[model samples]
Target chain A: MSETPTPDGSPSTWSEDRLHRWLAEQSWPATLAGSRGHDAAVLETFAGRPVLCTDQCIEGVHFELGAGGRAAGRKAVLRTLSDLAATAAVPFAVTLGVMAPRSIEGVPLEAWLRAAITGAHDAATEHGAELVAGDLAMVEGPIALAVTALGHTSSGTVPVGRDRAQPGQLVLLSGPVGGSLPSDRHLEPLPRIEAGVAIAAAGATAMMDVSDGLAWDLYRLARASGVTVRLETERIQPHPDAEDAAASSGRTPLDHGLHDGEDHELIATIAAEDWAAFRREGAASGWHVIGTVEAMDRSAGHLQLRSPEGHSAWLPGAGRGWDYGGGE
Target chain B: MSETPTPDGSPSTWSEDRLHRWLAEQSWPATLAGSRGHDAAVLETFAGRPVLCTDQCIEGVHFELGAGGRAAGRKAVLRTLSDLAATAAVPFAVTLGVMAPRSIEGVPLEAWLRAAITGAHDAATEHGAELVAGDLAMVEGPIALAVTALGHTSSGTVPVGRDRAQPGQLVLLSGPVGGSLPSDRHLEPLPRIEAGVAIAAAGATAMMDVSDGLAWDLYRLARASGVTVRLETERIQPHPDAEDAAASSGRTPLDHGLHDGEDHELIATIAAEDWAAFRREGAASGWHVIGTVEAMDRSAGHLQLRSPEGHSAWLPGAGRGWDYGGGE
Candidate 1:
């Protein structure tokens, strides 16, 4: 019996061996082989010394489909790397679950997947890690990629967390604190791994990657650490590029620096005594200290923003951040 | 700022913690701990060996939106466990990536997530595994869960893939084979883990889960192994309940036996001499011998069905396993 016809019955139109041949032609680095592209990888030690994190990059929420394949791929890997950076964990390996639209087919689909994986692999390689096990499936509509990365922090690594800061510690911002929107800074966040590693190695008190904006994320840190945070508006460092976008958009760059998420830089606190040496050690590589941590009423888990005149800018507010708590 | 109201949100809506608490309240045995509820569990070995498999279950493709919280959760974990069963890998621990729609507020969403986690925990516990790491995200739409489970077969544990069968080998069915419509068997198809472990231990030559129906998947195995497979029409065992459904649908139960996917049972080949012992070992437990491997020929990659009257059943050939290979 004849099988379903392909209109003209052209055997030349389809080649199942395409994917295999393409994969074979590509050269892969030796270091990445053990943990990347294989069905499974054996980890030497994942029990007590591992660092694990999960991040979701949704279709419209985390990224725009219009970003095209290359950027989509880049964004997918960066989102997860940003998480790893938050913990000051060195890169290791990652697993991804990708969902694509039903309308995608043939070369375009393969190319998209290849680009995403390659982008991730290249980035991981740059970070001294690899891309490992991943799952691919077709879905009905928008594209979504879920990534999980596992890493190991060498012994004595300070586990960077929002809750590790102590009262009376000096609040610090690692670098220029803006450039989150219009600049596409949110789409392509630098994981700040180097800064994190340096700080942790130098005995930093507590740390976290600035994702949900400096103002808001700092609030989370202060709340978790049971401290009241005071911010000097004049000293807040806004990314120079953010100011350009803000000028054109009729908004203040400080607003962008304070409210925009995805900066992916480190926001940390160190004991006031350690601040000078810490800032000196960090500044050799361009890290900066933006402010100080002062004693506030314990009952006030509040974030007070001060203008140049030392006047309060607002009342207790949930500073601008990405609200993933769903609808009202 | 006030959040916009959605139908799924109200004062009585669910909270995340409460939902997690409810998930902990499921009725499950203690041995299921490694499998049930953790971010991700680490298993030492599966049946004394190492094996790894991951399954991602999306909302629309894997389960209906109306499927109760508990059922949805159970199905998600089962889907992953089933994959492990197919590979004959003893399940160890599971890492979950759960994406929930944000529209529904409060308890229902929490309840659903909790239920899903619990279901996964139940399956893990049943399979003697642990839940260790998890990634959670709020998405724009329907809920989906991805479970990545790790199992350790003994160091010597090698997957009995379908392509390794040889001529003269006995083709065996692990249990009653059929009734794979999504409505009935999709949610609760038995994972042939026990059968898989037993078959592997008994020295199976090649194996695979009987998804995408017997005839279609058999074709794939034959192609992979470079062998011709012959199936006895009279000998092919139909599911016990296939006849009733076939009657109602005005189709033959044999059709159901040959076409329905999602059974998640193991279909494997055993050496000729080991056939009798294998059958004897599983007979009380429901394994059956359905066919034999034949010499490779021009049509070696095809599945030839020998009807009772020595005729061929060329009616619409059964076998496109569900390929949800697009975006959503």
Candidate 2:
């Protein structure tokens, strides 16, 4: 047996044990053990239900080396953490699977692996989660990373799903959206974990993270909940960078707000009667009311945008955005 | 904004939704939901410690497409499930992250994805685990699959770890090991979950799955447990295919048994006093005593093989086997 050639035509010399030891040295939660040097990791789950999610970050797909390995690693973990936030679950532990190329940007594969692990560790620690276990493989392919986030429901709470919205519920966004790519917000945006828990506690109905643009994700929510979501165009607030992006790209800020993906913000639907209390508590967190749920009308489309002048238009391809095969 | 070209110089046309619908149609446990089109999957833990592990199957590194996508998929899940067996943890659910190439074996990307998902579902369901959540990404690289297996301890049972072995304990194997690669046994070996639980219940001190050859994996167990393991060469039983492999390759069956990786068999250390009882109950399941653990001697090797003629030799490069970068 000999060393395999990497995609960049370099020899792969990193051993699996070398990578395992690097991961074991990182700070992990006390509840995580039996992972390093063992077959699997053991973790203690709280008395509530468990929430699990997995997301992948592929080079030249989710990111390129030009953005740095740290950003790619952080985005991998953040994507899964965003799902935990949408479910209103408390973070527990994460296991990473990395398929590394031989070399990245003139740096050895070891450096790239270290940077990625460090970024994942920092992000997990910041979110009260632990990096418990990981596996690494070198291949003659683009670098790819997979993060599996495990979480649990807190006491007296239940995980929120995307199919629980009811008619007459108001749709809300945790913060501004759009222009995420230009601002690098997709890699650094905060997961609304606390806000998600607060909303779930105050009786929010359906909820999800807006990773694939507001128009696409909202339509998914509407379809899952069997309801129609009508957005008030005048009430939408674009991210601060949206105007600059729109000016340079010949598109309106509203267009970017509706089409730009990877915002990593939480969105939920709250009953009209519960909106007052939710708003009173969530105002400091930048929760904004943007739309309302109504009875489904197949002719009107699942998602519709209405202007202040009383003109309504269907959002074309409302549930389509940023697919991996169809690159962004 | 357009479909990207795959590594094999073909266009990727598989959509995330198309793969999701295919997975959702598979037979899964009743408890798995909110996974097909949701951000995260929610599962109920059975009031026990949770076991988590992630393993990767990269195309070219783990298996080439020449082996077929179904074999690749089955191997991916089986690898993680083998870890679960080593821990004696009852499996609950599995989440698959697939990064697909444009095409495989002259088939469309969608066909490759469907075959892989179907194979994963079949293997997981056969082992009494649900295929709960999955993420699909089409990348300009070789196919990569990551299987994150989540399991839980049954009531009154605890997860077995590699650090619990003690000096004077006997080492045992679940079945013969050798010539796995040539026989294609590496891709389809049975994971010894029931046998592992039995051994644990009968008081196994330490345990691990023998994936990277008996010599390498035994050394790992010894190092983790702070002991030295000695094996009897005359007592070692090679698999039925090992003789043919050795005859064709001009090596001894013992050589193959010592170095051939990916056996997927369970190896455990048990107290000498408990061995009799374990053997009485586990013999029907093919458990065989193979060696003994002793105090570590830095001057000597962690693993030593002794022949009946009073000759001994240290296994060369113990714990170094089948690294992805090194190429097996």
Candidate 3:
């Protein structure tokens, strides 16, 4: 087999030194300090509270070569950004861990890496964050990108955590879900930073971004908060692509909305009284009241779906969504 | 063609859900908040300054299966900790990204994962940090582990960084270098956290961990600080195993000291006047004066060594060490 070509069209393998040189050439956030060649990147925090999270996007698992290296890079950083949004935190810096393949679809390894870094840089810039530090390795298999995003909340604001949802609260969905896969919405869903911050400021009791299917994530919220959640099936709006996805997958649009993964919409629980003020905040997307939080009952299940007919049943596929290691 | 077996001796793929469940059972740092099932682990920072770094250890690249999964895991975390030490930052939390192979030797996959996690956890604990978050995926190639370490500096102490070395500074090494491979010192070199902090406090201007070979890394420091470095060959001290490494490889112990990578020793530059004070501070193992910084002369090379006979020449193998992609 022929050797892989570097981005410079040379036969030399992509070295750590080359990677560092490329990173140094990029413009980082003003908050970043210290030289680029140091062992670590240092950042000064304005808000004392540091919000940190890590996420990985792997080939054949999170994305495929067909998705393009740019999308892969965007999704890797975006996934972690969504987590920061869940906590109502403002991102400041990110450190990337990239394991690159020898070649990507006959393209030079360097070209693929450049595309990936550009994608990450663009996404981070758009979200008010910067690529501060990163590590690169050459792997014999598919590419894997891991991102750790460091963020902070405003001085007096505490992060909205998943275990604080209270009973007698209104459940809100930032936007439509389901059928995200068919529309490729999973590749580039906007992280709900604005909506999350508004909702949190409006007294959101608890919140989380919906990554794995709506039902599965809701179940998680319920378990964490020691409460049960009831979703009104008819009130749940499917994405515009749900119809097409349902047609191809032999499932209803509502089913796709409930089970499809990577929606990246924010799901939050707020006091019933705060709902009006939250709505008046004028979040980019109008909120949808899809459910309510109730006292937990072990025998009744932690999560249920209420049909328009007033009948309720435990959500189907209680904890199923996309499984990286295959079987649900 | 058969399915890989988990460390638990079960014929199961390493699922994200399973990994989460496993993580939930472990004890995290007290500062860690939010539910275990959340998208990211949230940390409350005691120090306002955040230090971040990322490092990856890949099978066949950083280590082989013959070295054992535990050693691989330890080395991955150790590498990042070394970076933290170089900066004189105290590590608070770390997130792990692991891509497991279909099979590891004849051992079950689950067993291998268990060993790796145990190793990482032990290492983190030894350094007063915790594994707060992690991601795991299955790959068709060798296992890869990426670790992002988050740290902090005390209230008024600034992190030691590169690019501060002055032209008239003394270069110091915390310990010997070379021959880390056969002796397996690379797998478990003690990160000089205390030493680094003391050195930084005592007025070291520039510092870095020697992961790459001494000559190669010194060249990096020279380039970054905009000065040339001169090493006194007679003063260079090789590790105890360097002689054996030289015997087996048909090279001189000094060659191994200057070229073999994975030393993980701290190298620093201090003002000539501070050298006496630095020595008075009683740094562990004391410091070795290996070289001095001088005005940069592009034509004369960035790094050179002065022999005992009063002869000086540029170091051999300019930028040669361990190459991840292939041949050095």
The TM-scores, chain A only, for the candidates as listed are: 0.83, 0.90, 0.91
What is the CAPRI rating of model 3's predicted complex?
medium
Displacement of the residue A240 alpha carbon in candidate 2, Å:
0.9
Q: TM-score of model 2's chain A, to 2 decimals?
A: 0.90
Off by over 4 Å in 2: A1-13, A26-29, A33-35, A155-158, A280-284, A309-320, B1-12, B24-29, B33-36, B281-284, B309-320
DockQ in order: 0.17, 0.51, 0.53
* CA error at residue B163 for candidate 1, angstroms: 5.1
- Candidate 3 on B1-328: residue-level lDDT in tens? 1566655566545555566666666665456655565666666656647889999888887888777778888888988999988987888888788888655556666656767877887788899888777777778877888899988765566556787788989999988889998788888978788878777777787899988788878887887888889888878899888988988898889989988888889999988777887677666364689999999977657787778666444543433545454432
List, residue by residue over A1-328, the lDDT tens digit for candidate 1.
2223333432212212333234434664343312222223433333224555556677777777666656666677776776666666676666667766533432245555566657766766677665555666656545677776665564565465665667677677777767665777677777777776677666666677777678867776665565667777777778986787788877788888887777877887777667667656544264656555555554444466777766443332434555454221
lDDT (10s digit) by residue, model 2, range B1-328: 3655566654456777656555545556467434345677777667567888899987776787777778888889988899999998877888899987654545557766777877787788889887777788877688888999988766566567887778898888888889998988777868788888788888886899988888878877877777788887777789887887998999899888877888888899888878888666645377788888889866556777777766454543433355454432
Considering every candidate listed, which one attains the maximal DockQ?
3
Error of 3 at A56 (Å): 0.9
DockQ of 3: 0.53
Clash total of candidate 1: 40
lDDT of 1 by residue, B50-159 (tens): 33455567777678767766667676667667666755666666667777765464345655666677777676777776565566666655677877666545445555
Runs of candidate 3 with Cα error greater than 4 angstroms are: A1-13, A280-285, A309-320, A326-328, B1-12, B102-105, B309-320, B325-328
Give residue B272's error in model 1 in angstroms. Answer: 5.3
